[model samples]
Target: MTTDPREAGPRPPFPGEQQQERPGLTSKMTPAPDHGETSYVGKGLLTDRVALITGGDSGIGRAVSIAYAREGADVAISYLDAEQSDAEETARWVEQAGRRALLLPGDLRDEDHCRALVARTVAELGRIDILVNNAAAQTINDGLDDVTAHDLEGAFRANVFAMYYLAQAAVPHMRPGSAIVNSTSQQAKVADSTMLIYAATKGAIASLTIGLSNLLAPKGIRVNCVAPGPIWTPIQPIAKTPEQIEQLGADTPLGRAGQPAELAPAYVLLASREGSYMSGALVPVTGGTPMY
Candidate 1:
């Protein structure tokens, strides 16, 4: 999705672009991320499919849940205990779309929790046609010496490793035509000074997406990813300071941050039959950021 500079409204100044902080939560963002409630008009691309989305409680995940439901799919949302009210709110939105919503809460850092997340979704929804590995964590540090081993492991477990754990459990229940959409980041390609660890995890996610697409090709399961630039979401508030938050995504050619709603369409397109012929691809929704 592209944001025009003339339409960017007022943007506040922030710190150096190279800094990284925390993975902000949705509740405290300056202007909360749009969950795509009003604009999306579903075309039944995912009719009768069951979608399991990790971190579906907010941000892009919540937007995708609503979009999928509007397309005639039942949804099962998995979230960490960090946010309960948001999860309930997201479920309500899904239900409002006339689709069943199941809430599964747990820590994805644990392999068992990851496995159970998919198992429960299948037990409740019968079969899983869409699995979104969107849950992740990141703690900003100065540089390599500042990154603790624990921090590295934590980021990996939540960002990239959990995808493997959850996919291993969910793939068995998936048949032909199922899709897996992993959330990568612009940092995967454009590295920042403080976000080295976080960027590394996202880079790993990109690699995993390509590898999984090949591994599951024979089984008719498609794997693709959306590498989003800065979209206004909770993760920003938690990860970056208020000043940094104010300037989010301004460095891009568009000179403004993106909204979660703007990024939702990419996930919808990838998960739905509209993108059936596409696989092993990375779709950049980074507001005119150069990727080559």
Candidate 2:
């Protein structure tokens, strides 16, 4: 497995330590994830296609957004209002690839806003060819007792519910051969006690990807998911302790956390014509987590 020197070593606090909200920024990360290195060249795989990615402001979402743009797809990134700067930065990079980027900022928790997200993307880009359900929320807790109704609902809304809402809105507009990619987590399979609620939501997302794939197959729209293991993203600081963040993905077989750029290629494959036969599948970019 090829590894980058920048992502190798004792992890530092994600760049700017501004503890503002659930989803944070790549620009603010201590070591900014490589959105696209010069080695990643455009191949026009998704030429003339349009893509809408939730949480595209940072982390895996940003990586996927940049990859799609480089692959010849116009990109639209949906993020929270607080992440405007990060979202715009992603847009600039997407545009740098000679593709148009629509910056759609709003709360995915709102059903109406979720619908509007797809509408705006389609309106701006002409049509929606790819929909990436990647936005998610999580918080560490002691155990089941620590998991409250609000906490579960918030995680579900951000992680699973909005995925459903966004897919429902985008599917009709998607023509034959369109693709939808959801982001599940390794925790969904080997969940720790501290992340029970968050894991449950991701588990649902894995199932959702399967069911949606079957439902949309007749329409020629493929649906799949990328189950990431411990990745070094802003979510670590917001959801886990500083000490926990320090150890990030050390327990994995890779003995280190994954960078967002590493996972983006999986998304690119699923979103492009290359994955036309792939549907109802979960591709584990989990550092050898052994999903089976």
Candidate 3:
């Protein structure tokens, strides 16, 4: 079966009034984003491995959880307590994939909580072979004046600082050949003013991934990042206006928003043995959008 890439998934202008408050839910999405529920077919690429994915409750995190589980890795997910329902749903998918799933709910803004997520994953899942730093906090702003100090701190804490917090605690426990994959964004280079703070943090993550890869390379641990283009996930409705939601991913070269399922294979490649020589790499899965 052959399908055209541009029309492989849903295209815009999307239907209905898609809008929600912070920390949105998949159930609220009109067509509902696909997390590889019936699409991804694992080939035991990560068998016997254990993975810890932050923000694994939904969106890209959820999709990765399902893919990793099917690839034969036990999965642990970290999420804010408010998203427990979504988190449980993700756990279900992992379990259905015939792998273990651990749910850790807490705010990643706290360094202690970030460290604890790694600790608990190691304790319950046996060991962490892949750490996916996919959780993030994004807020749309009008301009510099609309951004506040607290807003900046919140974004950095959850998006950048927490990656360090978890890495610091997990690396020692991880063995050689382990990998750390992060989620940056196309906006990191494309530079969107409306999402200024969010884009800034994503840029910082890309830098950190490179520097961290160098620091961990000698230990035989690889680090990489994925810069996503416009993807359909709960994060869109939560952070964007209803108007923006309707036109989501309409500007992409592919002519449609990438789904969370579309982003999973990239995470899998970076975290699996197939990507052994891929450290410090920034893999772009932006629906043909360019990233420099």
Candidate 4:
């Protein structure tokens, strides 16, 4: 039977579920996310390139990794050790696409590990032509009073600090045509009250992308960011209460949550030669929500 691609639509009401940990696994998500496994067609846009992506085990990161491999780039995916199974699954897809897939499992919060990850990717893959700093951490708090110092620090460490660490390590190996894509969020501009810390880190990432673009442009490197709107990923069930999950993405102008597959094209565009002139640009895939 032929499958209909358009049949995958906005998620139905989730029955209030939560993962026991942060950055939930893709294997456990209900009606598993679409990472363009059977869809994305490649025309060798990234032929002979090497890419290193953090948080590549699932969600948007996984989607981008798959797309990159299909586009002819060897991909090195880094993810938390707990998500090893998911990361391996992503590597399988890359291998299926006739590209090399390297799995680097570690915590990005550690500066040394971040540096090691870049070094290891270069050692294994030869050189870094693309870097996607897509890993992030988020937790919902009732209010500012409920926010703790640990929560604030953890968010920044995972979302912002890791980006800085990876970029610093990767830049030396990145040639003039190399690209760095950071994953910002719609919250970077909209600012959700319960997720203040997470939103703040994303705001910082947006600024970092612009600033890095200016700093790296002289060396022929491009830095840009993607500010995703409400996309259905494992982060939601873990970050939101069950009731919140049911209403997830309802407030968007499109009246639905986006799929992970929907975000890969933007990353692909930014990493491809087509986007050679695009730097310091913030591409929003927020289902019609204006970033301004």
Q: What C-alpha lDDT do the candidate models reach, one value each?
A: 0.84, 0.83, 0.92, 0.90
Tell me how candidate 1 scores on lDDT.
Answer: 0.84
Candidates 1 and 4: which is better by lDDT?
4
Q: Report the candidate with higher TM-score, 1 versus 4.
A: 4
Where does candidate 4 stray beyond 4 Å?
1-8, 18-20
lDDT of 4 by residue, 1-292 (tens): 1244223455556556655476588888776788899888898999999999999989999999999999999999999999999999999999999999999999988999999999999998999999999999985777778878888888899999999999999999999899999999999999988888889999999999999999999999999999998788888888877787787777776676788988999999999999999999999998778988
- Model 2 lDDT, residue 22, Cα: 59
Which ranges in model 1 have alpha carbons more than 4 Å from their true place?
1-25
TM-score of each: 0.93, 0.93, 0.98, 0.96
Q: What does the lDDT read for residue 243 in candidate 1? A: 65
Better model by lDDT: candidate 2 vs candidate 4:
4
Q: Judging by TM-score against the true structure, name the best candidate.
A: 3
Residue lDDT tens for model 3, 177-234: 9999999999899979899989999999999999999999999999999999988898
Looking at model 3, how many pairs of residues clash? 0
**Span of ten consecutive residues with least summed lDDT in model 1:** 14-23
Model 4 pairs in collision: 16-242
Q: Per-candidate RMSD vs. true structure?
A: 3.0, 2.5, 0.9, 2.1
